[model samples]
Target: MDANFAFLRLPDPRLYRRSNLTFSLLFLIKFGVKSFKFNTRLKMQEKLVAAKYEISRAVKADLAAITRIYNASVLEQNATATLRPVSIEEREAWFDAHEAANRPIYVLREICDANLTSEDGETFEADCERKFDSKGANLGAQKPSVTNPKGEILAWGSLSDYHPREGYRITAKISVYVAPEARGKGLGGRLVNFILENAPKFGVKNIVALIFSSNAASLNLFAKFGFARWGELPEVCDMGGKIESLTILGKKLG
Candidate 1:
């Protein structure tokens, strides 16, 4: 064969084997990565289930716990624009504004079983009993009944009207606040899921979240739920002179 024709000859057998081995290695690597991701997700979901949490509509009795959680955010984090802690009385009025049929507040609580014991060997039942007996006395008739024992509230979420105008009735703004101690436990994701699932039932078509641009955690949480960054206002919030920007994320539901 001529020199030019020699270059087009059949490839070496060794090269074929090497290419096959390289392809096999690449396939295994890709499969391993996918498997690892799926297993990690499964473990996270299992941990959430084992934590024994329940989400329910907020009640008049839960305003205190809800207020306490929000106040913690105000003091420790830039999650809200408020610089100072709010009073229970103020939160009570805010809670009254949430109409259950339209706009509602939901609380996530840790369910404590009577038979469960803590790491320190203290029975949760006895601890709850002591708390109820002492604190319940002050609450008087406002104390919850045994059949509907109040659990420790870990987080709260709400859907508020985006605007008062009739044309804006279909859009609502969402907010989620997790207690400082409960951060990184997937409570935020749970609340967001619940909110999106139920928003359509109350005539809401679009949900928006006004998050701080610097708050990557909150921004990512909403993004995972298919929310897109629709708009932003630079330097709109003077959060204690920190000069924070706001990111408006929105999602439309079917």
Candidate 2:
């Protein structure tokens, strides 16, 4: 008998049956895991295609949401060097500085109408209509109406002055952060593209991204946009005693 089939011709037929059953069960488990992962990836891709989004300049109302997202990253310590969660007051100051310098902060919001339903089973538009009918000549009294109104904020990006020196005015550092639950769905890529497209409008001739060397996702995202590795600072950040290096990636705008 062939060596491969020797196990099938075991002295005890019961042993052969047990071994075959175990082999079959192991194969099914491995195959099932692979299938499950593939199906999950497919569903994510489908959701990405079906979802709608709106990207606009950040406003004061968005500051709190923006701060929350950034603070989450601060706690993770994987994307940013900040060791502690920052206060909303600190972020407000940062937002004011960006506004004053004409360095815009952009936010990406998912657009959906599902959240507009009221507890009374009326849609937002319907509720607005009822209020408008009851209050004559006061269209403004009704709740503000928007076409495909804003949903939860998914991500935000900004271009800040790379350096305060006069000569460095043409250069800007780029930063992007995505909500933990909304990641892996291409939201970050959308924000990056939007930022790059608008960088020149803000007088940005060169764009740089300062990312932790261990952040492979960020490095790959920037690399897709033609950003090249410009420099590296070895062991520059100490995140809770775990030394981390910093990688500087840059791209020149036409």
Candidate 3:
């Protein structure tokens, strides 16, 4: 009876070892499934982050933001030929003239990122504030006091009618302007490319860009899209104090 009791008190090594092995295998399987799911979710998020912007037609409500982006280029003096900033009201007529079928003004807006949310899990609105003059003074009612924080316009591209004549109906000119803070982010290239791909749908057989000779960035941007120098005018633009030459670049599409 004492021998039997001693044998019962001894541990069952085989049974215990089998139980431990089963637990370890279960844990590894669970961990592998969770890690695979996490990796898959991370890859999907990366794809979403790649498309951080959108392009759409400029509505009446977008004129203020568009004007601000345009004025930013004006202040830079490297992109546009304008020496002074344009007023919103002054651009109202120009905005109204862009018809969807003939001339379209497309605005590129930034999509709010998930990481930019507040602690309360609410997304923050982008600051679309217009810049003040060199004197650091905001002009009269021309400026918008409140701007939409969501979907802020980062750049704008337009296809304007090249001529009002009947014979030149198939010709159109392109213009792209990026916000001061948003430059060098490939926004201009994206906007211009959007216009090029969609221009043919609007009966545009030829697209032209009138760029300043000194603007190598703009020239290169157009050239990347197969635009060639068709003509040039020397000393055509008087930029306040200095006169600049203009280059004519065009692309003929099928």
Candidate 4:
């Protein structure tokens, strides 16, 4: 991905929380039951969904690009609450902190022109390349270790620190971002599903996602993963423009 694509605006945390919620859900019993169903096997399919995007850990080499993408999210006034842009130095610090704590940073990349199959007749990614050439698919050939060929990364999702308490160690805050070009492709759904399925390996018992009240895409993504609202702040942030509300969405892991 080219970091030079300045058109991709980052999240403006303050403005987002204050924006009127495009949609609202009352704290009703029916709503609760429907939400709970996703966590149970009774409605597991509804809990996890995805587009054709690929998910993988962020390699050290991916830091520059990862930083670029994240910063893009930061620039969007609606995506985050923070008014300041994230810096690479801070990202490196985050890397060090996660490494020391054994946490992980994930990256979703569009598979490059890549052939990713063991089949010899033709390249796997090459076939995919022909199929989605217009869409600019990342054939998954760049990372030979990650099997299964696919088109380029349309979006990515992640698990951030949950909280600062010991009991809460089994929890994580999740975030998903799809390239603006890749929205509506189900990539966010796919990334969230992959993360939820693997949450337990990291000892996660709860999955949390902090979103601006106006962020419909993120809210829907969490809902797709069976996450429900646990807390709400009427207006926790004050961006230069206005104040915004915050909603915390969470799901029990096991």
- Writing each residue's lDDT as its tens digit, candidate 1 over 1-254 gives 59889789687999999999999999999999778666655444344334768899998888888888899889865789989999889987788888633699999986644444433343322222222344332111112257448557779999999997878989999999987767888999999999999998888999999998999999999999999989999999987768999999999998
Give candidate 4 regions above 4 Å deviation.
Answer: 1-53, 113-154
Encode model 2's per-residue lDDT on 1-254: one tens digit a residue.
Answer: 58878667438788899999999999999999778666655444344334657899998888887998898899889998889999888898999999999999999876533224333333332212212225342111112246324656668999999998889999999999987756887889999999999899988899999999999999999999999999999999999999999999999999
Worst 10 residues of 2 by lDDT: 135-144
| Candidate 1, pairs of clashing residues | none
Residue pairs with colliding backbones in model 2 are: none
Q: How accurate is candidate 4 locally (lDDT)?
A: 0.64
Model 3 C-alpha lDDT per residue in residues 1-254, reported as the tens digit of each score: 99888767677799899999999999999999778666555554444333568899888788898999889888878778878999999888887777633589999876544443433344443332443567765321121234554466778999987877878879999999887766777889999889988998888999999999999999999998899999999998888888889999999997
lDDT of 4 by residue, 106-187 (tens): 6676554332332222222222222333666532223334442333344556676777777778888887766554567676
Query: How accurate locally, in lDDT, is each candidate?
Result: 0.79, 0.80, 0.78, 0.64
In model 3, which runs have C-alpha deviations exceeding 4 angstroms?
1-50, 113-150
- Ranking, lDDT, top scorer first: 2, 1, 3, 4
Q: In terms of lDDT, which candidate is stronger, 1 or 3?
A: 1
Question: Candidate 2: deviation at residue 164, Å?
Answer: 0.8
Off by over 4 Å in 2: 1-50, 114-149
Q: TM-score of predicted model 2?
A: 0.68
Per-model TM-score on C-alpha atoms: 0.69, 0.68, 0.68, 0.64
Query: Which window of ten consecutive residues has the lowest lDDT sum in model 1?
Result: 135-144
